[model samples]
Target: MADLGLFGPGTVTWRVHAEPILFVGGLRSLYLQALHPRAMAGVAQNSHYKNDPWGRLVRTSIYVATAVYGTTAEAQEAGRRLRALHARMRARDPFTGEVFRIDEPDLLRWVHVAEVESFITTARQAGVPLTDAEVDTYYDEQRRVAELAGLDPATVPASAAEVAAYYESMQPELRVTRDSAEALVFLTAPPVPWKLNPAVRLGLELGGPRLLYLGVASTALGLLPTWARRLYGGFGLPIEGFTAGLSARALRTALAALPSRYVQGPIYQGAMARAAAAQT
Candidate 1:
């Protein structure tokens, strides 16, 4: 039988993550992560995301895919690589002028919570049909991922209530910084490539990228929590849930309509095959 990875085929993580709306989750995670000044500082100093934005996105997507779908050995190796990377990376404190490891427990916990919360909320608003219990299960399951990232699972939030408390406790610490502002600008309208800049800038023949940028970016921004949106200059006006839901459902349906070859990459296919093999 093939290795079915950590959650295998039976877990909520499998179902929740398999949806196309996770693309929005990924973007939403970034929008949420950037609001933390310290977290954003780590990225600003240690990551080349600024120079290679798409590459950074692809790498992050690949890591999450591998962690979720890879065989046991594959997942462990990915975790090992992550621990080693985090061990070696350092960031300077923007306010205190102190040096710190990028993998400090508080930092890791913040990033992990931000990511888990972003993915879960995005799934819910995108109409993924997760029950409250399933949502809690998903959060509990994600502790394994936090462990993989060198965080102590015990320190991570393990249920919906815990996650909410964690966020409430974290609210005072969340704020924009110079690093975050720069990242937002880049993420909002990333530099058009030298080759395509003219056409894209002129709106001549290349409108697709611009439209996609606006669509995904706006939807992700709208999907942020009321407090997060407030930090980003939004009034959190009532709530953007209605419009965001419409956008998320639309994106979900459209992506679901894509050919399997386009929607299901090698990681997903190989995992599904291994799952079937194990059953047989």
Candidate 2:
């Protein structure tokens, strides 16, 4: 029997994640995640994202893809490695002088909700044909992903309403710290890694990729909720939402025109094939 991973092809999680626009969704989640002071502090102190932003992005994308499409055991092993890594890392609170583990339930839950919520929001904004109830199902389907990341599934938000409540309850703990501001600038235009050839570096600095990334960053930033925008020192207007929706749809359409093999990874293709075979 072929393994269909944690979420089979029939699941909303699988169907939604196949969209090319999820790249924007991933960036949107990062913008959302940086709102929590503790989370931002942990990342600033422990993560090399500033120096190796591209590498970190690729690694994160791979992990997410594996969780969505890897076989059950493969997904479990990936989660185990992530948990082991997080368990060994600790961050210090500069203000309180308290040390905390990176794998704390609250922090993990925050990340998970921000991620899944961003994915659904991005899809919706891009004119993807997902109904409201289906959005809730996508959130519920993602609890398995939270469990893989060392979060207790029950602690993770499992519905759109639950996610709204979770964010509302978490507001007291969310704020923009010095690190968050710095991270915003970095994530907007991270320092170019030295590994790229001079031409590629030039492209990143003064060429097409820079303009493309600016679009992605702008769309992601604009798609942020009003409160999150306020935390980041920007007030989002109604026009911002409209413009963001248009940009997201345009970007999605552009990417969607690419060949399926280019947009969807091997794991996703293989999982869908297995799912088709199982049905037959």
Candidate 3:
């Protein structure tokens, strides 16, 4: 096992350097959770690995790692390693008795898109200026991964408009009543744990900012009259009230308290500036 302490500073510093990534990732998780009732069902049906535990854990870990590291070679390496670990888990399907491959395209596509979109959207939200070319490049890379998984590359949307359309088509599959924007919040939150890995463990620890953000948002929504929350929820604006009510002080506190390996101030400031500038 890698020394946890050695990895600690890198992980923490990474958390700071990668806040935009985290934000988008959190939103993506929220979207998937809100959408996929069959998420749990898929695991039970398709997963042959015993208990389907490690597979889910490693997948989430990779997602977190990708978010913190961006879509660079380092992040890809982390994902590759995690994929190997997942492939080692062995179990047979009760019905088909088929063994599962950790690198299955369906699962890989989900991870790839979630991470890519998380990085892109978070950077954009933070105000990072991205050229159309940059956005296209990111989309193309994700599409390549999707193709590798045997999914239609066309199914990977090329623009924001396409993403909106795709989400519309998927509305029936989603569990939440929110619109795409609100659904994004849930899609990118931390994933539910199915198994444990160091990366995932670290992610859970480093998830303080996201958890705080969501908690405040949820509470704010609850405080509104029931009709208001429901109305907004109907429009897919679940946390608008809560986000609006957030104080600068609260946001600062949450940012400061987030567990990260690096000196938080500089990294966070850089990320914030980049976000502001629209540099995804």
Highest-TM-score candidate: 2
TM-score of each: 0.95, 0.96, 0.45
How do the residues 41-132 of candidate 1 rate in per-residue lDDT, one tens digit apiece? 99999988867887888888888999999988888899999999999998888999999999999999999998988898888988889899
lDDT of each: 0.87, 0.89, 0.45
Candidate 3 residue spans exceeding 4 A from truth: 1-17, 20-24, 43-115, 131-133, 144-155, 176-260, 263-280
Residue range 41-84, candidate 3, lDDT tens digits: 34434454334434654565544544343334444555566556
Model 1 misplaced stretches (Cα beyond 4 Å): 193-206
Tell me the RMSD of model 3 versus the true structure.
10.9
Weakest 10 consecutive residues of candidate 1 by summed lDDT: 197-206
lDDT of 1 at 72: 82
In model 1, the Cα lDDT at residue 176 comes to 86
**Top model number, lDDT:** 2
Candidate 2, poorest ten consecutive residues by summed lDDT:
89-98
lDDT tens per residue, model 2, 1-280: 8888898867888889999899989999998998888887889889988778889998999899999998999899999999999999899875677999999999999999999999999999999999989999999899999999898888788889999999999998888888888888887887777888998988789988888889899999999988888888887687887899999999989998898878988878878888888888
Q: What is candidate 2's TM-score against the reference?
A: 0.96
